[model samples]
Target chain A: MFKNVAVVGATGAVGQIVRRLLEERNFPAEKFRFLASARSAGTKLTFKGEEHTIEELTKDCFAGSDLVIASTPDDIAQEYLPSAVEAGCKVIDESGYWRMKEGVALVIPEVNPQDALDAKGIIASPNCSTTQMVLALKPLHDAAKVKRVIVSTYQATSGAGVQGTADLFDGSKAFLSGEKYEYKAFTHPIAFNCIPQIGGEKADGYTSEELKMLYETRKILGDDSILVNPTAVRVPVANCHSESITVETERPISPQEARELFEAFPGIQVIDDLPNSAYPLPSTCDGSDLVYIGRIRKDISNPNGLSFWCVSDNLRKGAATNAVQIGELLAKNL
Target chain B: MFKNVAVVGATGAVGQIVRRLLEERNFPAEKFRFLASARSAGTKLTFKGEEHTIEELTKDCFAGSDLVIASTPDDIAQEYLPSAVEAGCKVIDESGYWRMKEGVALVIPEVNPQDALDAKGIIASPNCSTTQMVLALKPLHDAAKVKRVIVSTYQATSGAGVQGTADLFDGSKAFLSGEKYEYKAFTHPIAFNCIPQIGGEKADGYTSEELKMLYETRKILGDDSILVNPTAVRVPVANCHSESITVETERPISPQEARELFEAFPGIQVIDDLPNSAYPLPSTCDGSDLVYIGRIRKDISNPNGLSFWCVSDNLRKGAATNAVQIGELLAKNL
Candidate 1:
């Protein structure tokens, strides 16, 4: 077991969830440390039936901790994570910064745990949207080679962090009362509306978030040949992210076969009953750590294509739960 | 000009818009009559600044009217539209019943005006979701033959009728107040949530609304070979419908060429400036009559595939406006 485990960005949204999950799962660790930025430092937070003050994060803060799990913004991860690795700590990052860097493993424990077990540097979790989709595609790609994917995401406000959910609730109240609200988290009003663009523009007219869905899927699945066309949009839902996904494979996977494949896979639950109005919904799937699949059917457009709806709590399976699961996998290997 | 024109279903959501559009466009009709179901028959509505009492819709109501434009439910259209045809009235319907009927011509004026002009019986307007997508696809398909389409819709509650919007508002209010509210129009809560299924279940696990995107596109474009895969979802927006559409064509249509084609196509406006976050949004496209296209980019999965984001007022271009435009076309041909 690790002598000490440090949780970075402990006061942030995903960080808070990570703290809870570590406690709930009774994670194997000798000592726990909570760290955050200077602005959030000195804040008192309860971790495991005891009060702990959040320590200010710095480049030299990782010397004693043998394991570091961070959930900070990109710049913070970029600046501080390398210090942890140099300090001889097993670092797992939950930021967008280090995932695509050469020699850094992007790990989804269910999809590719061996990469995490073999990593020498900071291990990275994927973007929230990419994590859920890659987990769903893992079983399919293993059974029948997934050639191409067309995905349109209905992402929730919480994916934007704590301020995003705040904006959604506050802006919604103002909209219902006919008052103008100045949004802080999004450029446009997300209450009772949809925003087609998620992250800032990247190359080829795709947003940075859309491109991540493509690049991250390739990295995690270790198949650079898989092509992904993604359109990421923000919806008003407060928690879970949902996607309408269509995949074309080397061979046709019937709905019946797809259902069995999903059920047999780890970290996925199939909830597809159309006659009774059953499917994976954001409200129903919120707070869960499993990727939920529903509306599984044949894509009538292509002979080898299959279409389905996927939903997962962006904070849990998509972020905090995923990071904690990675910590558990590493601990088990040790 | 037609001597007499009758507006059926003149009190509901789309009906009100049809009334306003006719007045706003200064339709060339010598006389106007408003008709509705028995529940709304005695209601008073103003047309061109004059108060008109709604007459009860019946088979005998078409005696003097030379033209009829209808926006009613399927059963009403299924029962009454044939009567108007038999009464020698040039009928235009905005219901789903007659749209796919053998003798009826499903029309989108910008895409298939000639179909409206050539119809011997009831000329039908396509579904709102189908209308905007077909219009956007028309320009691309003309330049390169569209072989397949995969569309995911973010439909507004207004498409569910007045009750749907009410449920959204009231349910949102209740949800914000932490109160339990029963939904009226949808099986699940649509307040800040998405329901993947729009219409009732049809064959092959596709909803009726999803199949319409497939069947309606084939009929309106006069091409039965074009394949479509659609996932229709209802969002919390109050007015417009948004769609994420990807099309694979016979040849590659570059983003620049697609933009030029969309700019030249009537009823389509391009708003794709991602750097400034200027894509078409439901909040911005709520009242517009034209279909708005944005986020035009290459489908990285297929060399021949192109993707775009589309938004339009479901009540206007999707229903009332299309029906009124069809009436104007037939009036001119007279």
Candidate 2:
């Protein structure tokens, strides 16, 4: 296909993962270029047995690239994305900026690869919180049709990027050594505590992260009628994000059916066996691209309601891995 | 009006707090006795400037006591609680064994103190997860009548008692020091994880800990018609439990009105200033009997649905302090 690939924000935490995954997955990029901010530019990252310099991410960086995987913040994605598209580059963005915008596909390759194939310019990847959620919801909704989702996320600090994961270690060391530390990566201390807000407030008092789950789920799942109520809280963990989800289906879906549906789904591994003490935990699920699902049961409150717990490495399946998977799907047809 | 009070399982984590709260809250105990299993019988604990020997718990241990506070595991409480009540002692139990038993008042004194006074022999304190949840639900349920509740808990390891807390410290130190650590306090490693299952599996694939939240909330709120769905998770924390709650009321409850209701209710302090990053965290709410709530907002899915975050010291409001409050209530009626 002779596809030339460029990665923006290629020196960030997610960018490093993308760089590693490109070689690990043997991504079909004939030519590769890395771009980051001015501070990270001129740094070296190796890909496919060749060293590549991280160029400054500017308007002109995407001139020869056929596909650009953007892992920058939302504002940066918005600022430079149009230029990438104008330069004839198809962007798979890892930001919340263009997710809900008109005509842009919010894609999870495992759940909806077809959406990515149909996108015209930029295909937006779901948020880290949203990616793992919709992946779990996809199989369940396919069979019984999900009516409502009441989810509470036990998200990790790594979702905040490199600084968030670094602060977790630094804050813990400061506390364990009896010195004082205030976490700058998060709004509150993240060493041994939980914070309730992920981003600034949005409409209806939901944080931007919470709203991303609601909106992105509908867009990626292609079901706007599905009602979602999400509470996203940041825990002290460094990697995998966990969610306790209660879903109401249009028809009854038992625990057995839910388990079977999840097991059959791609990018999902079921680790559910209660008696022998087997279930999903964020710590154990770290470093995996697959979202782990367990604690499958029926919600006692509603007859058609099902409850389950899911975990995924926020850096892998939540962001870089999924972004790479989308690039794979896009590259095949290029 | 002299009160002869006895505390059972006195050497355990919750039992130690029960002893301290008794003195710190100046519970009008004229003569105090400490009792535990035979291994801890001779150990001594101080109360009100007096040292008391721990007596071995037996059929005859409660003979001279007016009130007994039980803070043991389910099996231990089951083995000896009936004997304590039969021996003419009014007992406030902190174990899950008697919570849903017929006619055993599952009491949270701040929410339903009158239920304590109506007890025939023993009053059961709700589960730590249920304790913090109902406290937040009561005020909103009072003003708008909560019809359906969806709660996810970020419970602390201390809720597992001494061994659970010790494992958190041991596991973290082992991880930091690069030594292999196996966590016995939880089913998985508690160093940097979240375990979804608390107790063993029960009916319909739900864990015993999760069912406790469903059943206890109904009993404490005195409304079995209200639908409750809960996912109980144990986080890598030492003390205090937190909950992310989504409540559906009969009528819409605005964020402002919900805040005022929580503030007006006793044993609840509203800390919901989002602009300044004000919300409940397990770290800050330690050592208090009050349930701290914040992140109060209306749910986007349902007009009548309200969402909030709550935290409480599991040892205090969740167990010892709540049990003591019930004792104080029982004493006044006597």
Candidate 3:
């Protein structure tokens, strides 16, 4: 069994959560190691009451490790993942670099654990926005094949890392105090506003974040024929990301059936009581890992359409918890 | 013409903007009077550097007024608009109560000023969320004949009035200071979160605000065949409302042609240059009466589709400015 585990980028936001989940979930890691960039090499992080020093990640960092989990940027992950895989350590990466690559499995454990089991060297978790969306769509797609998805995201600040949350607080305070401060984390002031762009421009005028949702959803759900139209906007919330999703299916599915399917699915919770004002909002859904689905109703314009609201902690279900879940699934066969 | 102008609800948020625009636009009003609720009856507002005492809005307040421009609550507008119209006063109302009524012409001066000119007694302006949308759609629909629209709105807190803005500022300050405060302006916390429901529940699971976008769009555009599907979400912005819009037209309209159409149309500005990140954001579009459209692209999922982003100051262009423009139109005929 793979008992020796190492977490790359150990001191980062998603990395801290991964470490915490490993301890909280009591994964069978007999020995644990931490790795990060040279600047953070000597930093100490607590795991199960013991302080572990983060080492500068190098090719030899994964020599004795049986499994490696990375929550690094695209360039860092791309640079270090091959070395870890070559050292006979199984790898799970939380970066956009390798997700679209051939021979790599983009796994959302609740939707597709089989992809993780069939991984070749490196398994990838889908982007933060894509993970929650596919989790909500998988069961419904099985009942009625999804044809098109029109989504507008109200993403929180934490998706940009800890710096994003800081920028939100600092920018908001700047506006309130009548002080001028340049927005550092995002392209514009994220306080009291919504920016329509999340990532740099990509193919055909879509941002990289929008493209991630487009293609990663297809890969994770194992359906390439699904058409996804995404408009990703950044809101000022600290943690959870909310989506207004309108789905058109090849077969008709009523809102009741869709609600039941979401409720019965794993890692999904239905909070859709309108009379109680119980639809998912970031204030209520933050700090949790479940994908909260609510406000389900049929689109009156299209016969095969159903629309709903979804929210989930981008740091948890969207990133770390999903990566940790994949680690759990991979551990079963090890 | 329109020499005696009375602005009802003068001490309120939208009413303040209406008073400002009336003065700034140099409307042909020789005598100006301000009217508000009984509580604000003794307050004063300025018009063209002249102070006017706000009187209590009563049935007889409009007796000598040639044009009554009102920005009051729904019930207040319902109670007073009829009396104003019966007292030899032409009225332009910024309330949702009479907007969808059988004979009340819902006017966006840019889209349907003719409807304002042919008004029976009281002309109605569409909801703030609907007004910006129909302004962006009218020029395009005149070119390609719109068939269906799917939109998600990022509305500002000012749409809820001054108390809503207070809640946002106070709620955000509380959340930042580690204090718990319940949201009063909205059902959920609007400090950093987005609330999906805008108004009370209405027909077929849509909020009243959503239904306003549905019926008001068709009414203002004078095309009852056009279908609109809207998801109205209140964001943290204090002034501007943003929208992610996808339109399916009878014939395909390229992004270039749509940009040209919007550029040529009055009361609309095209801020779409992806390379420069010059799209319309709330921070830049606030306090302006023009509807700003950007991020225009062809929706690859459907052959006859185009998608874009829109932002407008909900207070200026959507409500008060629109009402004032109708008053200007009424002045022309008087």
CA displacement after TM-score superposition, residue A174 of candidate 2 (Å) = 2.2
Candidate order (lDDT): 1, 3, 2
Which portions of model 2 miss their true places by more than 4 Å?
none
Which residue pairs clash in candidate 2? none
Predicted complex 2: CAPRI docking category: medium
Identify the superior model by TM-score, candidate 2 or candidate 3: 3
Cα RMSD, each candidate: 0.8, 1.7, 1.1
Mark the 10 consecutive residues where model 3 chain B has the least summed lDDT: B43-52
Q: Worst lDDT window (10 residues) for model 2 chain B?
A: B1-10
The best candidate by TM-score is 1
Q: Show where candidate 3 strays beyond 4 Å.
A: none
Candidate 1 chain B, poorest ten consecutive residues by summed lDDT: B110-119
User: Would you give me the overall lDDT of model 1?
Assistant: 0.95
Between prediction 1 and prediction 3, which has the larger DockQ? 1
Q: How many clashing pairs in candidate 1?
A: 0
The deviation in Å at residue A61 for candidate 2 is 2.2
How well does candidate 1 score on lDDT at residue A314? 96
**DockQ score for model 2:** 0.73
Q: Which ten residues in a row have the lowest lDDT in candidate 2 chain A?
A: A1-10
